[model samples]
Structures are given as structure tokens and as C-alpha cells.
Target: MMVGATIIDIGTRKALEANGASIASGALAQANDASYDIVSDGGGCTDAKFIISGTFTTAPTENTTLAVYAQPLDIDGTNDADAPETTRPTVFVGTVQVNNVTSTQYFELLAENVPWKANYYLHNNGTGQTLSAGWKMDVIPYTSSPSA
Candidate 1:
């Protein structure tokens, strides 16, 4: 299930806070790929934000998109490449617009009622362009917990 909003306008977004939970942040240098990746620990994670930047010598073609996907793994699935997308992965979880060669954009994923153990995937729909992403995953205190 989807959580939060499906809006792309960052104008209405307020500064995000992780509250008291631990956050894992890292640089994502992934290129266009056909496979999904287990980004990191989602043990106590509730949401994830992918801030993408693409710096190029020349401006890239217009309407290019860089996508971020979070696929909920099957309960009985093993952490391996063999777990095909059709079986347990969901594609196109979120995307960023890279209309310019030097583009900066972001996309966020928030879990619904229950937390999901999923892997993150990145892909660029266009070729001949170079892009990189910085990813941050936020852990929210479990709502049902007394301390939350």
C-alpha cells in the first residue's frame, strides 16, 4: 500500500526530521541497471528520500527521468538476484525529473500502516547521460510502541 502523498511539488514540503530515530545516509552512485539492490538496513526504517544530482559537460536531453523503486520482498524469499521482479518486486516506486544536464531533484517513499522489508532499485530511462544520487533512509519510531 502507498503512504503519504503522491505529489511531486516540493513547494509544499517542510523540512523533514527523523525525530529520535537513527538514520542511515549514503551516496548512491548507481548507474542504469536491470536489477534491483538491497540498499541497506530497513529494520527500523519508515521512509526513504532519494536526492539525485546529475552534472554533465553538456545539458542532457529533455524529459529524461531517473527512477527509484522499492520492491517489497516476499516473506520466504532469499536475498538474491534470482528473486525476479515479476514475483515480488514493484517497479517505478518513485522518480526524479532530469530535464537538464545539471539537474537536482528528489523523491521520497513512505511506508503505510505496516513496515515493509523491501529492496531499492535505481534506473535511468535515458542513455548517454551521467547521473548520481544521494540516498537517505529515515527510521520512524513504531507507532504502536509506547515510546513512539
Candidate 2:
């Protein structure tokens, strides 16, 4: 028997900033502080795609590169908020490059091959650029067939 691949939308396009505040330039912050829990699908997620879309409030002086990362919880399913500072580690998945970004300009980055983990986080590469108040990131995980 073969099961069709299933796609799971982690958080329904959750905003990078929880409070609807602009992400300041030269700052590194987590996307909603592990907002989307990837383990809810019985931990069968094998691959994922990171979708980031939003407008830039403050454009970068030069070409800007935004990097996305994923931070998984401990093997015992310990949340970052409860784990020790030194136990959590983030893995670099991919990046989006914005050239000549302008205010109110819409941009979208679709990064593939992002491994499914316990959780995820978004990091802005601090290129003197700020995302408008409504930036959003969506994580879509693809589950492999049980018999595959």
C-alpha cells in the first residue's frame, strides 16, 4: 500500500512579528518565538518549504540578504522557552536576496528543502533593512508516504 504525500501548513501564514511591529534593521529575532509546532503531525514530516512574504518599510541602502533558519527543540521535546540557553542550536536553511528594495514593495521568498524539525525561527540578516509591520512566514511540511 502507498500513501499519498501530505502537506501540512504549520501556522497558517503567521506573522514574523507577533505584535504587528516593524522589525528594526540590524536586529536578529525569532519568528513568534517558535510559534509553529512541527511535531503536531505525528513527527512524520520529512521535508518542508519556507515561504516568506511581506513589504519593506525601510529599504536597504545596498542589496540585502535575508537568511532563514530552523531551531529544533531538544530530543525530549523541550521547548526553547524551557530549555537551557546552551542546548538550543539553529540550522541555516536558505536565504533570500532583495535588490533595490523600496518602501511598500512586496517581496516573497520561497526556500525549498528545509528539513522538518520540532520548530522553526526566522532571522533577518541585519542589513540595515526593516520589514513592514505585516511580514509573514509560512512553513509547509511534506510528509512521506508511510510505506515508502
Candidate 3:
């Protein structure tokens, strides 16, 4: 036996300032063992839905950049050399990954329960080839957390 389902529609609520929507876009960036910022690198809002999509320049080989939701943290007490790297503290609410490097293959990560601290990052681990990519994020603010 199973229970019934319930659904709600969240239309564009421009008049509702607290529940308004927003879009964040980025230009194409080339990478080779480099990281690029996609969304709020150090800031985010709860009760919001995020749709992150992007395209790559060429078909990456077996190893390519990884799309992740992580936070930056102070590694050491005082030394700048001891600071955490760009893609440090990989704390993800969901399994995030970029499947391939093909131009036709784009990556889309849907994060809903994203905390107000996590930031989106794209890590390109390609050794030899440089891959060009661009990313976009659609943020939908909500009054309360949405159901799964």
C-alpha cells in the first residue's frame, strides 16, 4: 500500500519580495587543473532551489573538472600558506559530478536543501588539455523549505 501525493505550484512571485526569484550567470572560462566560481562562493540562502548548468569546450578525457558544493575554511591559525585550497571542504547535500567533457554533454546540478554556507565550485583536473566552460545558476527563493 502507498499514500497519495500532494503538489503545490510556485509561480513567479515578483510582488512577494521575500519569495522572489533570481538568476546568476557566468562567462565562459578556460581551465586546466583550475577552479572557477559559479555561485555565491561564500554566501547562500536557505529555503531556495538552485539549478546549475554548464557546457564544456571540448570532450574532456577520463579526468575532467568536478562540479561540487563546498565551503572554504581556514586551514591554519595564521599562515597564508596553510590556507585551504579553492575547492576545499567538499560538503555536499547531494551527489555532484560532471559526467563527461563532451560539448554536447552539459552538467546540471539541482540543489534544494543547500545551506546558507555552501558555495558552488568547478574543479578542472585535466592534465594536458585545457577545457573551456561556462556556468549558470537559477535561484528560486521560497518562504519555506520545499518537500521532496
Best TM-score goes to which candidate? 2
> Ranking under lDDT, best-scoring first?
2, 1, 3
**Candidate 2 residue 12 C-alpha distance from true site, Å:** 8.6
Between prediction 1 and prediction 2, the one with superior TM-score is: 2
Regions of candidate 3 where Cα sits further than 4 Å from its true position: 1-4, 8-49, 62-65, 72-87, 93-101, 125-133, 141-148
Of the candidates numbered 1 and 2, which has the greater lDDT value?
2
Whole-model Cα lDDT per candidate?
0.37, 0.52, 0.36
Best by lDDT: 2
Clash count list over all predictions? 0, 0, 1
Better of 2 and 3 by TM-score: 2
Task: Summarize candidate 3's per-residue lDDT along 43-80 as a digit string, tens digits.
Answer: 33334444445454544445334444444233254222
What TM-score would every model get versus the actual structure?
0.43, 0.60, 0.42
How well does candidate 2 match the true structure, expressed as C-alpha RMSD? Answer: 5.7
Error of 3 at 112 (Å): 4.6
For candidate 3, the 10 contiguous residues with the lowest summed lDDT are 14-23
